[model samples]
Target: MKISARNTLKGTVKEIKEGVVNNEITIQLAGGQEIISIITQTSSNALGLKLGKAVTAVIKASNVMVAVED
Candidate 1:
């Protein structure tokens, strides 16, 4: 898979929450960090995402925002 995204983290599928139109995927990184992504149900099924499966989290964005409680 060749793409323009440079921030790719390899991890294992930790959990999957299937919804009506989308599915939430949780990936656990080597350092114990977890990243969650929500994708379309169709795409999720096509990728065959499952628990314990090795996968890569591709991160591509123009802007990333951080938040804090006031």
Candidate 2:
């Protein structure tokens, strides 16, 4: 599939937390870092996400905020 997001990271499904409306998904990147995404339950089921499954995290955002500790 074609996506407009450029920040696509390949990762493996680490965990899946199911909820009534949404599902929390965690993907572990190559360097051991993890990214979490909350998607609708229907979408989650449509994708058929499971542990150890390889997936790509498509990140498309208008603004990303960053902060530094004092």
Candidate 3:
């Protein structure tokens, strides 16, 4: 898949949390980092995401904010 998103990380599906309207996907990167994404149930089913399945996490955002403990 090709898109304008530059931030793409290769990882494997670690866990899947099914919800009524959406599904939570957890991907574990090579460096042991985990990224979670929430997508529509239909989209999740269409992609066929499953445990141990290889996938890519694409990140596209207009602005990213960071906050620290006060």
C-alpha TM-score for every candidate: 0.85, 0.87, 0.86
lDDT against the true structure, each candidate: 0.91, 0.91, 0.91
Q: Candidate 3, residue 39: CA error in Å?
A: 0.4
**lDDT by residue (tens digit), candidate 3, 1-70:** 5798768899999999999999999999999999999999899899999999999998875534578999
Rate residue 12 of model 3 by lDDT: 97
lDDT of each residue in 1-70, candidate 2, tens digit only = 7977767889999999999999999999999999999999999899989999999998876545568999
- Model 3 bad stretches (over 4 Å): 66-70
The lDDT, on a scale of 0 to 1, for candidate 1 is: 0.91
RMSD of 1: 2.2
Instruction: State in Å the error of residue 21, model 1.
Output: 0.7
Sort order, TM-score high to low:
2, 3, 1
Could you tell which candidate, 1 or 3, scores higher by TM-score?
A: 3
- Give candidate 3's error at residue 24 in angstroms: 0.5
Per-prediction backbone clash count? 0, 0, 0
| Candidate 3, lDDT over the whole model | 0.91
What local lDDT does model 3 show for residue 1? 58
